[model samples]
Target chain A: MDDQDQQLVFINWLEDHSASVMKVARAYTLNSEDCQDLAQEILLQAWRSVPKFSGKSTAATWFYRVALNTAMNWKRKDKPRRESQQPLIDINVPEPHGPDSSERLLHQEMIENLYQAIHQLPKTDAALVLLYLDELSYQEMAEVLGVTENSIGVKLNRAKKKLATILNGGCDES
Target chain B: MNLDEYRQAWKEDEAQMNITFDSDLLSKEVLRSHQSFQSMIYWRDFREVGVSLVMIPLWLLLGSMMSLPWTWYLTIPALIWIAAFIFVDRSRHPQRPSHPGEPLLFYAKESLEQTEHQIWLLRNIFWWYLLPFCISIMAFFVNVAWNSSDGLLGFSLLSGIGAIFLYVIYSAVYRLNQTAVTEQLEPRRDDLQRLIDSLERETDDENAGDIMELVAAISESESGCGACSGWLNWAENWNRLVPSWQTATAIILPTLAGALCGWYSGTQLQIPEMGPTLFQVIVGAVIPFEIVFFSICWSSSKKQKKIQVARDEEAASKPEDRIKTTSSDNGIRLPKAPALVILVLVIFLGVMAFVAIGAFFLHMKEDLNAHNAQVIKRSFHCTNRV
Candidate 1:
């Protein structure tokens, strides 16, 4: 397809799935600025990769794989850049917001807490947790993660337990 | 919270996630990255071809200036070998369009074919490289030996053995590269393949296999099997005999080396001016044997692995026979070393040492007689002077 046509399709997909990139960036980076850079990279990659999309996988699966892969690579590349000047920024800690229903606010707190727990995970485990939180099926997660289904089952189980421990504040025990 | 509770929260948050980049900037970035990616691939291929083209002429010039009659002839065979190597390599994996950017199955297929080609080169590298290399070295040796009346026989013997050493190096390199492919690359390739295969299978496309088979057949027909077909068919038995060959070399070479060192020390034969010191000869004989023997043993360990894979495949294909075959033979085991073999080796070395020692004393006797005659002549001269 022509550039104009491709861009139109990409804009539509980006509008739908921009959150996946942002989420992956959050997990990968140490700050909002790095997250912005990573998400932009993911968007660019997705645009380049859209032509090769075989439609063998769901759009979400494709987006998650692209965003996660791009973010992971950006983190690896940007590490030295970060280490040279500033201290590491913790992106997983939620911004303090004001005014919402108590129930909605509680759920938001739980989600933020869950992301914090995931952020502290090993990179791959964090990815598994992200996919798990998205409620992707084992097969879809396997495709996105490039992990075997059987291995994913084991890793996902471990990741869930780890998340639970973190959420329970088990590590906080003296 | 559990994922079930987290799902509602994700839905709410996802709605608010913004597209941080404007379309104009995103489009510019996308176009630029794609352009750079294409250029990078082209540069890689260009650099490889450019270096190779330059080196070919340099090697030819160096060979010509080498101090032997056959050195100039080296270029012809060298040229032929390079042409054949490239031809056979290309034919073995008919040049496919590269897919650097694709992921999953496309990546898998590309990676698989590239590695398979590498493995093929590793397998048959002797024909492309070592054989010609041996021939060139043999030519140089023959030319030098022909000038020495008695050294010609020794030269022939050493050159023939040298070719075997070249073959050993070829096998060791091939098996090493093969092991890497088996251990590391194959699993990733298989995983990607499995994913692709599952997707295809889910579509209930029964004819997918036939279509893929047809494509494979066409590609394979255009490509030779990366071997000298005639030689391969003839030497298929060599694969089975490889263990015995290693055993023979381990026992024979060390004894031969010891005998040569002993004979040279006895002054039985004049060593060649270039690279024929007893130490060099012994090391040359012993080292290649050691290299060949060790690699053969290493490759043999891989046989048990292959057997496991085979057993699994067999079980999958025919489940009824699984119980019976559980205790079946793993791939051809290296035969146990019998007592008689060790005894025979000891006897051979003993006889070699005896010959070497006997020659040394016999030569010493001649020197002693010559010394006695000189002493007698000196005594006669003194008596005449008085």
Candidate 2:
């Protein structure tokens, strides 16, 4: 494809599937800064990968594969540097506003707990949980992860169990 | 809440976190980043091949100027061989497949293949990169020493020293490339392999029912009152003082020591003035050092200023807005460099400027002396003819 056409397709895909990028970035990284970094990296990779879109797979599948692969590599590369330094402060959760503020706050807390639990799982399992949480079907997840549908089911069940353990463990401690 | 409710919340949060981008801006940013990345690889390839290409012209120029024997020119073909070898090898390996749209397993495997190829090139660098150049350089040195007034002893000594020096440099290059492969590339390759294995390996389905039951039980038993410990921010605190003096000393002392060592060696060897003088050598060395040092300091200061600005903005804004501001900044910034670093930089620049001025005057003086000698020789010839 020509550069303009390729770019047009990429921007549309990015707009359509940006949520997946954000979720993958959030699931893989520990902080907003790293999330931003990983998100930009995924975007760049996606932009580069646009010309290779063959219409064989859906754009969502292609973008997820790009983001997940980029996140996995990024996490591995950034591990040592992240481990060396201690964070000075925690990221502040945005205050819930308007009607049903308390309900929004509770949901926010659950989501935060969900992310923390996700962080504790193995990288691949974390990816599976993120895909599952995003409501990707077993077949879609299989295509993104390059595994059999049956394999996705088995691995994802195991990952979900591990995730539940972490979340419940956090709740009991609290 | 059940898994279905959690999915609902996830989708809700994803909606609330709706990030819109200006396609033009994003495209420009991506293009800029892609160009920078491509240029870095291009620069590295140029450095590797450009050196050999440059040596061909240099060899011819020196050969013509010195009136060396025809055999000395043979090294040109050897130099070409080295450059062509690198070019061909790089072309053969190519870059990682550009299509990241492939399955994760396939993409990871392609990446692993690229890393393994890099390791192979570095591991066998002696054959393609070093050996041909070594042979050409030795040949040139042997030809020069053979044609010199000093006889057999001088030839043997020159050839022996040349071989040893080349060996040291080539071996060091070999060792460094191997070290990089071991310390960096090999580990990355292994990581990719493991990732591929995990993706390709299927899990047993027998335990799927048990795991699903466990997940359901855990979800049903949850109270949903887990404390929302905030995510850790990645910003590093830059309030501590940097030991600028120690850093300056560490950089400056070794450079001065190396210059002194070079001077001492020159004096001890009573080296012939076939090329640059000590002053010239020092100037040549210091210019590159100053350029590199200044670039590093400039980049560091710029980075510090950016971080300081971001921090100031974050501090002034509401807590809820801080994440938005920082995330939009798109890069990690630290506080400005300590005053001591600036002070050291000024002093360093001042010293280098003084050295540079002195070298310029010395060069002018040499030119004036040569001009005077030519004038006197012409006058003597005129007087003799009269």
Candidate 3:
């Protein structure tokens, strides 16, 4: 209804979704500092873009779209051209974790494995996997990707298999 | 190891994470970048101001010289030199065409060609008009020196008329040959107009839509946009008449007083039957000031009238866009006393005129002494006459 109302809603949405998007962003960024920077950048884009949202898709879907677009474009453009290269973090999963913390460590290792597997996939497939993980409907994903829902469905199926193969350590290099 | 495990961990991290940010600090960076981007658009105009300042002295010097009552011999050559310089300047550094529809790589080529075509008309002012007039003036001076006043007067008038004729000719040539130059120039002008329009667009709380929408609404307004509005502002209020008036006065007043003094003093010197020389001194003095005074007044009045029309057009513009409450400096003072102030001004002018007349009388006496000395030296050398 007004600027203050819109800003409050945007901030609330940003706070709720920031951690989820930050983890996705971490999969691509190399270090703790880069992860923090990427997360802030995503938040910034969401702030600027919220005023223009037509609401054809859910807010989460729009957020995922902007985040993925910003991340992929940044990685592609920034990687070799920029001199300051900070590679992704090497998160070490310690042996069998502490006696009481084995489950949490195992869960962290699985998430790390998912991130590694996603990185090995082509950019478009990786984006598809990330959107699917965010639980965006096929139609909502289509709007973000600027493609048909049927096409998104097809891409998702192919991406899932690629991701599966990558996770299994039998990923096709091509 | 599985999707469920990854999902569960993601849920855990999402729930546990809490990040703090100071938005005002972050937005300051964003605002800084926007300001940087906005500042770039004015770089060219800033350069133009610098260039114009450099040209001001040169323009004033030439303008004053143009008003001098020296024999046509000196005036003609000076005009020619000025004409050549203008031609060279126009030819070498034409006004760059600032806009064309972009297919990016080809845009430069098309715009460059348009710039060239624009300079074609510019060249007409320099070469065809100014050059021919200068040459004709020189030719007239030579004819007058050879005892042909009728020929000199006829050719001088021809040269003056030729300047206008050349401008018309060139304008026609541009119309026929370079229609695209005119069309391409319009959009660049429009872009400036749009920028000005956007600046003035309402950011008031009552307005709907985003900044972009506000910009669009402003573009659609009857004032026909911001850049157009600025042009209207310039065309109306900034058509400076006073500078030309000052220039004309400076050149004319001194020379006119000098000529009348020259004639009166020369007559007193009793130069045997040289009525024409005395008349020449008087007419010469009066002609230059009259020409300069009348020319400046005519040009300034023409510009003023044109500006008045432009102002009227701008006044007709009604921007229904919500008015932005800018931090307007209210202390800008309008000049008081208006035309009535001229009563006091005339007193000062009269005193200056009297001083100028006195100076001219002194200069005329010196001229007479120099002439008598030359005649005495000639007489001493005339052995057969002695």
Candidate 2 residue-wise lDDT, B1-386, digit = tens: 45667778998887776566566666665665565545545765787788889878877865665455676688788888888887887788665344556666676666777777878888888887788778877886676556542468978987888789888998999999999989977777766766666666686443222210001111101111011101112123221223355545654655565556556655665454322246544654465556545655666668777976776466334222213323122344333455345455547655655454444334434554576788899999999999
What TM-score would each prediction reach against the true structure?
Answer: 0.47, 0.67, 0.37
Number of clashing pairs, model 1?
0
- In order of DockQ, best first, we have 2, 1, 3
Q: At residue A101, give the lDDT of candidate 3.
A: 76
Reference-based lDDT, residue B52, model 3? 41
Q: What is the TM-score (0 to 1) of candidate 2?
A: 0.67
Correct interface contacts retained, every candidate: 0.11, 0.26, 0.05
Instruction: Give the runs in model 3 whose Cα sits over 4 Å from its true position.
Output: A1-3, A75-99, A171-174, B2-5, B27-30, B36-386
Q: In angstroms, give how far residue B339 of model 1 lies from its true place.
A: 56
Measured by TM-score, how close is model 3 to the native structure? Answer: 0.37
Name model 1 segments beyond 4 Å from true.
A25-41, A51-94, A99-109, A112-174, B16-19, B22-32, B46-51, B66-124, B127-150, B157-179, B186-386
Better of 1 and 2 by lDDT: 2
Indicate the docking level reached by candidate 3: incorrect
- Tell me the tens digit of each residue's lDDT in model 3 across B257-284: 7677756756667563343344446544
Q: Give residue A29's error in model 3 in angstroms.
A: 2.4
Q: Which stretches of candidate 2 lie over 4 Å from their true place?
A: A1-16, A75-95, A170-174, B1-5, B68-74, B148-154, B204-323, B327-386
Ranking by lDDT: 2, 1, 3
